[model samples]
Target: MKSSHILLLLSLASTGAAAFELGAPKNNNTDNLVWTGHLSPDTDSVTSALIAAHIYGGTAVVPEGINPESQFVLDYCQIAAPKPLNDFSQKAVGLVDFNQKTQLHPTIDESSIVAIVDHHAIGGAPVNMTQVTPIDIRAWGSAATILADRAESLDIDLPAHLACTTLAGILSDTVVFQSSTTTEYDRYYAKELAKEAGIVDLKAFGQKMLEAKSDLSHISAAEILTMDYKNFSYGGKKVGIGVAETLTAQQLLDRRNEFVAAMISYKETQKLDHLFFAVIDTKNKRANLLWIDDIDAAIAAKAFTGQPKQGWLVLDGVTSRKRQIGPAIQGAIEGKK
Candidate 1:
């Protein structure tokens, strides 16, 4: 390892993120560490788990089945997806992509978490983590960026498949750098990973990935809502947010009645105080927000600048749910008396 990179690791050690060690297992523990991501495994979540396990000596697992985009990436790279982990009881685990209790498996024990490498905000994470636990939580766009950075710093050359998949993870999470959540780290590592993956045109590769993601014709309305869904809490109000990106936004909008019915059922079944679904046009860089009813629409109106058009809240040039939609809804809910 280069001196600068070694110093970088030492710097991380001084901070709370000091659990990463290259070479053999810490204390010669022969037990295999299990790495996983959030509940609804997207491209970033699944790929980050795989990258984390490969870099840190563990097996990658997913809480549930992965999305089409993730599956497409894995298949395109000729890499096997992680096996499903129904229960994480008493297992030595590492988390990637998300660090929230709501996102974890119901059977996961807090003490079982050995490490966490994420790019989202820290909320309801395990507080009783061991002193030597590695907790690398940054504000980067994707967890893959952080793990790829570690591999680069340690001079650990990832195989071509992992490298390509890592690049796919970054592209998926950051929306190919179109999302506002993207950062310099994401961009830097994206170029490096693209080069290592032997991808000639990064944007072309991303478009192919999005093409796979947009092929949601066969999935049911409920499945489409939850495929990329996440639950959040704001000011004691339970909220569920769902986003669907497609090249043909009109096709998804054509099924508006079905989406509305599904949204109503989802909100009621989940007992959520607020629920909003956005159909993002990946090519046009816009979103059509879907709500269940008047009450849902009223609440959603407060969050986005979009106006209602043909029973959809049309957000022009708004392509990000995490940066544009989620936070806006959070602020709207929290600001409410």
Candidate 2:
């Protein structure tokens, strides 16, 4: 891209009112490098991209959406967020938070990826490969943990609020250290990052961050689903699972009809085979899995072995969807086939 177009793109990323949603513009330069997160970027996704960009000497760009808590941290730390990313064709790119092709921007050239740091499931197997260096995706709680390890090893001094911002990703992905995937490294890194961030109380800070993201007012049920959703393909079946964490499941239950209606519309529009959502009670450690019909409801029960009450499945001890829900659903589907 020319310097003039670069200036225009950067200006839009930083200045537009709805700049994040602009996707990516066309006919841009390819020589530039970008570290990008997944769609509806959470704390880990955003922080991982930012930290990786710094380490790899690239610009960290936002995905399609930003979690409310991440936005809060950016505002709190007075950090300027990189603009949202649209197309990745021709441009050098590094992916964080997710490696799945569906979660990536469609226009992105997977061959352009030089590195990927994620903790979720891999996309479909790579077809011929070239330079996919440092492709690290483990079963850890947070992708931030991976980058945090690097920073500590390098003894790098983080910018203001950078540590805290990255810590939020670890806390959120680990459900404040209550997730089944939480590792010893995650805890140790949290403390290390807390010291760098000048955080005195970890749990209190985590709770505050969760509360900041639990706000559902002025948001439709459809928005809630797409805000933090994931797409999966198992046995040639397309599955869309959206996990929306909240301190108050009751508030969401109040709009059961609205949720079901939205789910039906979304399923039709997206042409999905299995579409489901979970409203997690992060404070109490439970979930209410919502569905549009009986088949989907039955699949939920088979997936998590939870009993549905009033069109909602009450799932206990199920915090991380990566461990608990996705595998269960894939099992259910395979078992039927």
Candidate 3:
């Protein structure tokens, strides 16, 4: 069968919109293309796929958000394009089955997946992974940027809805591209994607998204910790770091006491060798590091000089993980050796 005919059949299948069966590749691979990449399968990646599927006519099965205790069905299976699937409502899907543990399985049945894109450390590769085609995973700012790049490279015209979704994904994942993980590739691709989608004033849009997430009135300190929590092993010990960014140091400082207390509590509970909570003042390009272990203060003192100062260490030149924090931590760790 011709490739065009296959695509036409896929579009027609989208109209029926059945539940995604596991282990099936939705698109026929007469060409036997092996699209592969690392799949962490976070929100940005899932949402990016959803938008792309909408544009290309496919199903998107997205699980709930990070919260696992809440009783909600964040999972939604829907068709991506041609005026949205009628069976699925337009409301933003909430965390589905919050009680269910979320796991990233390497293979979804052939009937479910058309492509995969992600940005996290690669997990063990799977056998007979039929769903993900043209997988593109880079440990960078956002998978949305990767998807946008793919769409552009293929010369695939992006619909306005998909474009807006992609834009939002980039803003959220990159923290408006101010995150340490943000890369030049992310910025360049986002700019081009925004232009292609006819989105102007991306800066303002990013600000709006940041403001929306920054509202702390309803969020607790613990909630903030889990949003960007990561752990690493060093010197036969485990260290965990949580990062939060705010418009002003004072704004982050307002939560300083609570955040510090939370770090201590998390450290004891998780039994980590060390815990570091960093509040980044994006506007000033400064960072305030809150330490939960003895080495942290010493590490900061040697790395930055001066007294520990209220369990807080000020870093003037420190701004991002890739640019500043990662290097500082590496230096401190290496210095210990």
Instruction: Name the top lDDT candidate.
Output: 1
Highest-scoring model, TM-score = 1
Alpha carbon lDDT at 168, candidate 1? 96
lDDT for model 1 comes to: 0.81
Give candidate 3 regions above 4 Å deviation: 1-46, 49-141, 173-184, 196-198, 302-310, 334-337
Model 1 per-residue lDDT at 129: 45
TM-score of each: 0.89, 0.87, 0.62
What RMSD does each model have against the real structure? Answer: 4.0, 9.6, 10.3
Instruction: Summarize candidate 1's per-residue lDDT along 225-300 as a digit string, tens digits.
Output: 9999888777777888899988888889889999989988989988988899999998888989987777666678
Lowest-lDDT window of 10 residues in candidate 3?
1-10
Q: What's the lDDT for all of these models?
A: 0.81, 0.74, 0.51
Tens-digit lDDT string for candidate 3 (18-76): 42221232433312222211122233544565555543444444422432211010221
Residue 26 of candidate 3: its Cα lDDT? 44
Write down the RMSD of candidate 2 (Cα, Å).
Answer: 9.6
Q: Which residue pairs in model 2 clash with each other? A: 1-29, 24-86
Compose the digit string of candidate 2's lDDT tens values, residues 113-203: 6566777765332312243244666667898987777676555678757888788889989989988899887898889888888888988
